[model samples]
Target: MKEIFEYRALLIELVKRDIKKKYRRSILGILWSMLNPFFTMLIIAMVFSSFFKFAIKNFPVYLLTGQLIFNFYSEATNTAMGSILENASLIKKVYVPKHIFPIARVLSSGVNFILSLPGLVLVILITKAPVKFPIVFSFVPVLYVLFFCFGVGLLLASITVYFRDMFHLYGVLLTAISYLTPLFYPKEIVPEKYMFLIKLNPMVYFVDLFRDMVYYGKMPTLDEHLNCIFIIIISLFVGVVVFNMNKKKFILHI
Candidate 1:
């Protein structure tokens, strides 16, 4: 804890730099973070509502819930894919915990997610969707999501340092997992025989929990909550093990 505190400034600095670089030179600047996801959700909602004719009301809100959660995973892993490579010079010049790079990447995404919250509120208010009791209890799942992101970021950051190919592979994996996890559709749409497979992906639970709290206006089952915890624990375990074992090679490799 003392060590983490000592490096807190470095973490903050990296996160700041990420947020700035993310919007640098763009005409909209920081507003892009807010607009990007919102517009993307709009397009998706339109497609599902018009072309596919999914009879869901307030589809934007439903889509936004998934977008918000999936965006965290996407942004964190996407940034993490090249974290060490991008900062090779800095890593070589200074002695800091290599883990900080991935943590900083995840923090930047967290900042964007927080900024998007107002839009979420506006949507809920405009749509007049009933906020659920689970909203009061949603903090628990959010914590699990953060831990899962941290763990995955750590693992990806370490691997990307050595295996440059992982960057490309991860992009494809992210796309595949996005559709596979029911981000655009409900679990009920899937055949009953395959329902069990969908639940195994872990992300499904997070998305379901978010939807339940925000859109469905209900609490998810205890099993759904436990699934997220399991994912967080296992992913963090792998991440810490791989990161500690290989972080020593980061400076040399990068």
Candidate 2:
């Protein structure tokens, strides 16, 4: 931890580089962050609305809430998973905490997520969803996701160094998770038997908590809070242990 704090400048530089690199040739630049989510919600909502019936009120806002939280987790972990290999040359040439690469990727993705918040606000305004003090507490859920990403990102980054196939495999996992999470649909429609499946998925808590606050105008329940705390603790513990144990072997594999 102290090492990261000391090298924080390098971390910040990497984050800035990632942000700029992500949109280097793009015409929209950073603005695309906001538009991407908005358009995604619009398209998903339209397509799903046409195909099936949903009683989910303010479907756009509900979808947006779940979409934004999941997108951040997906983007952060997917990018962070390859962080070690991405910085192979630098890691071999200079000494830096190997964990910083993944951390930087997650932080950079987080910047995009933050920039995308205005789109959510815009949707809320358009939908005229009730905005109350609890809505401001939406940040709590996002913060939970950020830490969740940190743990998952670190573990993936370390594992990918040894097993390159994890890169492709993680993509498949992300696809499955996107569906597993109730992004476009409501939990009410999930069959009773499948409720256990939904409960087992960690993203459920984060997405549902955020949705509860942002879309439903209520604070997250006690169970939601406890689930998040447990997830982060277990995630960080496994990630840190795995990363530290295998970090020395990274040079050979990378």
Candidate 3:
């Protein structure tokens, strides 16, 4: 931890470089961060609301809230996992804390997620979705997700250094996770027998918390708090332990 703090300036620069590099020559540049999710929500809302017909109210808001949150998780962990490999040359030539690479990737993705928020507001206004709870409260769940994603990233960064196939497997896992999450569908649609599946899905609580604040306009219940705490603890504990164990071996593998 001290090492990471000692080199905090480098971390800040990496984050800034990442954000700039992501949209360097693009015309829209950072605005793509906003439009990407907004356009994605448009396609999803159209397909689901028109053809498949989910009975969700303000379907655009519901879809975007979940999509934006999940997109951050998917993008953060994905980039973080590969960050070590991406900076292989630097690791070989320099002595900066290896942790910064993955951390930087997560922060860069987070910047994109934040930039995308204005698009959410535009959707809400155009759709005339009723705002229920204070939007500030939505950041509560976002904090939970951010930490959870970092933990996952740390763990994956460590693992992928050794087993390259983990990258491919993680992609498949994210696809499965997206389906299991109730992003485009209502919870009631799941059969009673499969209710346990919903409970076991970690993203369920995070998504529901964000939805509650943005779409449902309600405070998260004790159950939500407990679930999020448990998931975060488990993810961080495993991620930190595995990362520590494997970080020493990263240079050889990378």
Candidate 4:
């Protein structure tokens, strides 16, 4: 705990560096962050809204709510996994917690995620989704999601240090997980036989919780909410075990 506290300033500095460096030269600058997901939502909304012929009421908000949040999770883990490899030069330069690097990645993505919320609000107003009390009051889900991201980020960061192949597998997992998790489509779309499989994935609950709060303006089922919290706790606990075991070796490998 003291080591983590000692590294706090550097963590803030690294997170700032990541945010600035990510948008240093571009003409649009950080606006690209907002635009990238905006465009993705548009493309998806067009395809699904047209094909299903189901009225995707406020399609952008519906899509962006899920896309923006999920993108944070996906981007944070994938980028953070290679933190040690990416900072090989600094690995030996100073004594700091290696876990801080990947965590910094999560922090950077989280800042962007918060900034992007205004666009979601604009879409919500335009789409006429109810501006409910829960949307304003529900910080609980955000807390859970952050825990989930941190836990997953730590695990991925540790793995990528030892197994370079793990980085490539991250892409494949994201592709498959996106479909399996209910983002663009609803749970009802899945066949009854496969419904159990979707339920088993912990990510499904988080996504559903987000949709319920932002899109449907309803709280998730108590069971679903509790299950997600449980998964986050377990994932973080395992991540810490793996990361602590691997930390000493990270310097040597890098």
Q: Each model's TM-score? A: 0.93, 0.97, 0.96, 0.94
Question: How do the residues 17-94 of candidate 1 rate in per-residue lDDT, one tens digit apiece?
Answer: 999998888998877777788788878877785643455667778778888888887888789767878888888887
Stretches of model 4 off by over 4 angstroms after superposition: 53-56
Cα RMSD of all models vs. native, in order, equals 1.8, 1.1, 1.3, 1.7
What number of clashing residue pairs does each candidate have, in the order they appear?
A: 0, 0, 0, 0
Looking at model 2, residue 66 earns an lDDT score of: 96
Better of 1 and 3 by lDDT: 3
On lDDT, the candidate that comes out on top is 2
Ranking 1 against 2 by TM-score, winner? 2
42: Cα error in model 2, Å: 0.7
lDDT by residue for model 2 (1-254), tens: 89889999999999999999999999999999999999999999888865445477778888899999999999999999999999999999999999999999999999999999999999999889888778878888888989889999999999998889998999999898888899988778899998898888899889998988888888877977999999989999999899999999999998
What overall lDDT goes with each candidate model? 0.81, 0.91, 0.90, 0.79
Highest TM-score model number: 2
Q: Which stretches of candidate 2 lie over 4 Å from their true place?
A: 50-54
Which sections of candidate 1 miss by over 4 Å? 51-55
lDDT against true structure, model 1: 0.81
- lDDT at 92 for candidate 3? 93
Query: Which pairs of residues clash in candidate 2, taking residues 3 or more apart in a chain or in different chains?
Result: none
